[model samples]
Target chain A: MNWYRKLSIKQKQVVWAWTFLALPVLFYVVIRFYPTFGSVLLSFQDWNLLGSKTWIGLENYEKLVADPVFWKVFNNTFIYLLLGTPVSLLISFIIAYHLDKVSFLHATIRAMYFIPFMTSAVAMAWLWRWFYQPVPVGLFNNFLASIGISQLPFLKSTFSALPSVLAPAIWAGLGFQIIIFMAGLRAIPQSYYEAAQIDGVGPWTVLREITIPLLKPTLVFLVVFSSIGFLRIFDQVFNMTTNDPGGPLNSTKPLVLMIYDTAFNAFDMGYAAAQTVVLFTILLLVSLLQLYVMRERT
Target chain B: MKSWKKTIIGATAGAVMALSAGFAQAVEIEYWQYFYEARVTAIDTLIEKFEAENPDITVKHTTFPYADYRTKVAAAIPSGQGPDVVQLFYGWLNDYVEAKLITPLPTDAFPPAMIEKEFFPMVQAMKKDGAYMALPTAVRSLALFYNTRLFEEAGIDGPPKTLDELVEIAKKLTKKDAAGNITQVGITTGMNAQDHHWWREVLTRQFGGDPYKDDYKTVNYNDEAGAAALKWYSELETLHEVTQAGFMDEGQAAFKAGRAGMHIDGSFRIGALKSTRGLKWGVAELPAGPDGMKSNYSSYWVNGITSKATGEKKAAALKFLAFVTSDEAMQIWLDTVGELPAKPSAALTDANKADPVFGPFINGLGYAKTTIFANESGQRQVIMDAMQRILLEDQSPADAVAVAAEAEQKILNEYYK
Candidate 1:
């Protein structure tokens, strides 16, 4: 009360503004920061969800380095990220651009594209599993047969399984990226397009010069989020592959799946946590690297 | 002197009060089980009957789904919060017993002589250290489930009994289109293989190789017999060209849709098959291996009264266990669940023998064995993972077996030494 009385009107307003901001900061600390810190601590110990923990310094980290399975799963996860993210972004950006052009159908087409993101991952994975079934009677295989193409091993082949999983992952993820890009595109001042038109720019040149540059922030965000999603990929691979984790010779296994297997199946929680820390570091470094690259480009 | 007399009186009064309170309170026994909706209903009915009979004691029932039950039990027991009576898979017996987490019942409490006379020798031999840690309630085994409609279309008579005959039937049953793309599989393998340890165990046994030594101290499956077993398994996809890799679920669907002839699965699949209308099917034992060994690994759902239980509560739990293992309860279970009764007196009945769906199970039980539970979880995982790698990845059996043996030995040395 004394401080407020002593302060000028502007200083009082600044204090009120900070007080309002403090609430959200407190909320984040309680809900997010605390749990994140706790998980970091947990990563150093051997714990089952129900049991007492045993502390084992960096033994877990050491073991993770030697685990062949971890390398294979990590490779699969990177493959998923590499194959899924760009394809998704490209498709989404194109669709968003075209939908923006269509004045009347923009809303409906946007909604249609967003429907996959709205659908549950479990349900989508189940549907995709049925479609990827390996026999002639299977949905996709039947379609392939009608066109006289031999049935491809969509999930079972070690060479193709990661890409096969990526298809559904990309499909499920496209809607979000599309909506994000659409929002970003809508925010682009129409005056820029008009200026480009005055310069006699073609459609492709306008897209490359103006649209891509303007949407850089959104693209960077999508890349970061999608990279995180791909690195921790678990549910679809687990459900669709009958909990094989690494299906048909460690093809579809990802880092998260590896963590789950180590902790639950092998009862090596310390090692699992070590792997999780490695994943977190990788994610952090990648996100930072992306932000730096994007900022430099700008 | 007066103060001393007062102190002694106070102590006596306190002791008397405690005794009276103890007598007034009824003993409570905790029972844990894993049951689906129907089994839960049946068990609840049985509990009602048991409680009505035992008026002085109360039995608290806690249940979980099959998938979570094992982990729940493992966690609960060590925390001193485990139930006084528990149901478990027989495979978990050694692990629990080795930990001394379960109390072994006295041989006199069971009708031991009668059990010896009636039950299969293999069933009784599962016990260790001269004490039975668990009593089997229901049993299941692997069998060849064949689609009758597909067999008729292929002009085959019936299921084969030998490997050569199986191969011959498989070749005929396989349907390839003009372009040589496989339209239908003759057999399916590796479905549920990750969780279903029985399949690998049965195959290992049929190859005339025991995966674990009798003492449970060493693994013995790296020999020629083990390699032959694995090779034969791989040949289903690699050599015979009857089944394709990763076609297990598809083959099951096809079999259900009347497109495939044979699929190997456990007796638990009866309900799913029965639900598929207009599909003619039959069950037979898995084909014999080169050594004419027909032994297939089987598993049992078991029940046991805990050591923590005592007095009237113990009696009540025992009564319920006895009833579930009794002829009447076995009949209800068999009729409702289509599971083979573990008790000889119940399983050997005319009704069970006459039922086609359950008959193969009973026959298979004669040749059934179980993987040796050596009280080491790591060893089990290592061996099972190796088998999966071989079957799924087409790793040479020799290499797989060698790795598995080495891993098993390492685990044994670390944990059991």
Candidate 2:
């Protein structure tokens, strides 16, 4: 007790700093880490909401591996992540780059691009559902008919359903990614561009060499977040497909939707928990790999 | 800070005084339901009448959309924030009953003679352990909805009365382009939950096989009759090609646009269809199976007063439940919502007899039956999921039937054990 009281004022200051820093860390552990650990533990037990949980060990994991529907949903999720991420990034980057070029109306153009992000996912999904309707009264079908094309199966066909759902996700996501890219573009001092100009660097050359390299961190962050978002896709599949998750022959089924179906619809909490663990592990590993690749490049 | 504290104290005293006055004077009951627009308007009108009759009690009504009602109730009830009374779907009764989340109505609360006289026997089958789990307010049954214009264009005289005739007429009504891509379908095979149940029931009944045995311990969906029924359903899409694969919503849109011939759905769809202009539509009984068996599946909404509620709250809730199920209140519900009344006295009224839109539903009550065998919600979902896989994914009927039977049996064993 005497030693504690005799400590230096600098020591007390360090202790106070540590306490302030620990508050948020403690909160993260309690709220996020605790529930995640509980979910993983739940994966090993057979639990209905009201009943006593029985220990089943790896049985749920085994069942998940054998379940055909699980594999179907996993494939669908990867397809979405694979197709959705790069396309969204490219489109958003281009829009951000163009908006950056227009200094006068940049703020207005940015707000216009960001409005979709501000809209609720359910509202957007409903609007898109009406847009992709198969009848002539449907917006997309009417457009097709106007161009002398027969009505296409936008949301009704197995082949088109995944892409149709992806369209809205891309549309809603572009605003945030565009803002990030714009910030990254701003961070690159004009001196580099002026230097490149003196050296006779073309627009494409400047983009390839200086702009993209400088924006690597933002690109990496966007890719990781967007991939995670696409992997856990649920709302669009649920709302746009008439509450039929994985509609059109399980073509739009994603990992999170499958988890919900298993736990809530099928009441197989243990199996659903197992699926969640698997999804969490996959995302963790993929993100780690991405981080390593980015580090290596740097 | 001192002034703020004083204000808080003053507000707290005022709230306590208001609460004491409310409790001492009249019962305020919280009632939850899923209704919008016309149904909401009808319910609001009924509430005004109810409040007039029971001047001492005030009912606060909350509304949710039909889709989110189950989840909202489940979360609310567990947290003890649920309303004193809730409108429940018959399918949801088993889960809530098993969880003991609902209170059983006192036997004397509802007149037994009135129940026997007014309600269909099918609605009574929802009771568990000799206790009526819910009081059904409205009943709906599956019927064949035909596009009158399309039927006329196809030269079909009227709706089919037999399975073979339905297929034949459906085939004639289907329109295809030169490349053989189906532009318009004849029927949307699996549009709603009742449609799936209707198919299963008609097939099981026709095959002379019980889908679920009397004990409810076994599911016989893989039996010969069940298999035969499923095979025939598959033939509609695969062999005869009257129905298109992966085009259920498309088919519904087509039917709505006067391109398709028939839609198998519940009576609830009539309201939405009626809202459309210049569309001639008619409802008829589902075609009988080849074995001449007519199996009509019915679904309904039930209102149950909570077992947890007590004193004035309980009394008020029961009063509201009785009011909603009463002939007068049911008349308002039926007239506005297009749903058939669960009460016999209400169903037999002139309003019901004269309404052409609801005649098929009322008449179909004669052959009405619920899926008594697979009453468990889990088993029902499993069967439907399997059915979706088979119908949508082009899975082998035998394989789908086996998977469904196995899943159903597993659920039964789990629960019974």
Candidate 3:
């Protein structure tokens, strides 16, 4: 107590600031940083879930490099990020742009879009899986058959399976992206659009010159966010192909699903950790690259 | 009269005190299994009986969804937090053993000679390092489940006895629409389902090819006979056109919806099928191959004591394990779960052999084989991929089998090495 009374005001404020900051710092160190480093360490070891871990430096990474399935999974993850981020961004922006002009039943319409985002991923995936089944059982196939069109093997064919899985994933994320885009549109000053209208500029010019430029920050955030989401996709693919997860020659499998299979089904924890490290690295580089490209350039 | 009343009150008090003491000293053991309705009910009943018998021990039964069950066990066992006695698929024994997740049952409680004499020969798959790691209450074998109404409508008086006859009857039973789409398939086909097991254990063997070369440590099903079997199986969809893959989404679903004339499934399907109103179904042995060879695939879920169990917990777990595999429990399991008892003594009674629905499955036990899988999920994926390659990629059956053998061999080598 005597020592505290002798302390300077600056030192006392520093102590108070640290007292508040300590918990979260401790949390990030223990919960986040510890496992991050531990997984990196584990990548150089050999362990089943139950047995003792033995140091087998670089073997897991070597095996991963030589593995054909790993390469396929790596390719699938990139496809999801590249395809899912752009397509979803464009669709959601189009919806939000047009939707902002409408006034009747606006909240209800927004709610409808948001409902899918709120629904359980497992349930949505299952519902989509049912829709992809053959005629007499599937909704899409039945509709196609009724229209005298041949059945499309949406999920059964190896070539189309990955894109088919991606469709629903994109659709499910559309609502969230649309809401974010709408908020960005709302944040733009009315004066700029009013001035553009006064100048008698076309809607296309206004959209290109004013709306999109103003929405760039929202676009950047969503691009990075959805890219990470698509890269780490698991539940949708896992549930959609429950009987043969990532089936049709592993076409629809993503990196996280492979990590899950290695960790649990194969009980190869060290190898799974190695895969996790790879995924972490990919996420980091992808985010960093996106930030650099999308950074404000004024 | 006063002294007699005092004595009676004193005796009552003493008994109450003893009962409370017993409750205080009770050792609780946890049991874990995948959630299946009938299995959960059966295990619940067994737990109640076991608890009643031993007042000093309580058994806690926990179940996870079938999809998450393996993940739960894998995550929980290493932390010494999950189950004392856990139920695992028979095919997972090698994995469980390699991981040291389960301890072998005590020989004094379960002697080797007695197990060999009483249990079916296939239960020997649970043995490792001179001890039995697990014991099963019920066993399952695949059999033909034919819709009787469809059979009668097609004018087939009985099930086929040979492979050729099966295809002929299936063609006759098929119904098609004007658009050339099949409305009712003669048989259901999906390698993603039980067909993988059917192919590896039954069809391959019937066609004179052994699936494995050395106690399931080597992949040996890439031969001419294996290709021949693969051709026959794939031709059912590509050539015969009596059945199609992905019809009505799943084979069992199609059969349950009465759109499939015949389905091949384990005896476990019996309980569910029996409850479907207005559906007439009959069970039969799987048809023999061209050489009159017969084979069937048998599998089971076995209960084993986890390695974490020791001293008091071990004693309680062993007692619970023994109780579940006893004759009474086997009877209860068979009645509730529609699976055959693990032991011939409990399963091969006159009453069970005479039952129309269960008889064929029981008879299949005589020729049943359990494939010792090195990596069950990985190997299943390989076969499924091979089938898809033939059906979708237009690859030859011979090539598909060769590729599958290589992939499966890789899995085997990874596990065994």
Q: Considering every candidate listed, which one attains the maximal TM-score?
A: 3
Cα deviation in Å at residue B260, candidate 2? 3.7
Give a tens-digit lDDT track for model 2, residues B213-327. 6556778768777767777777887898887633535445556777678888777777778887888999888888777888787878788876557887888888888888887
| Cα-lDDT of candidate 3 | 0.91
Which candidate gets the maximum lDDT versus the true structure? 3
| Candidate 3 ranges with C-alpha deviation above 4 Å | A1-17, B1-20, B98-100
Q: Over the stretch B209-279, how does candidate 3's per-residue lDDT look in tens digits?
A: 99888888888899988999999999988899999887888889999999999999999998889888888
Candidate 3, residue B176: the lDDT equals 77
TM-score, ranked from best to worst:
3, 2, 1
What's the distance in Å from true for residue B155, model 2? 5.2
Kindly indicate the candidate among 2 and 3 with the higher DockQ.
3
RMSD of 3: 3.6
Assess the local accuracy of residue B306 in candidate 2 as a C-alpha lDDT between 0 and 100.
62
Estimate TM-scores for all models.
Answer: 0.83, 0.85, 0.95
Share of native C-alpha contacts between chains A and B (below 8 angstroms) recovered by candidate 3: 0.62
**Candidate 1 vs candidate 2: which has greater lDDT?**
2
- Expressed as tens digits, the lDDT of each residue in B352-403 for candidate 1 is 7777778878888877866655433455556555656765576787887788
Ranking by lDDT: 3, 2, 1
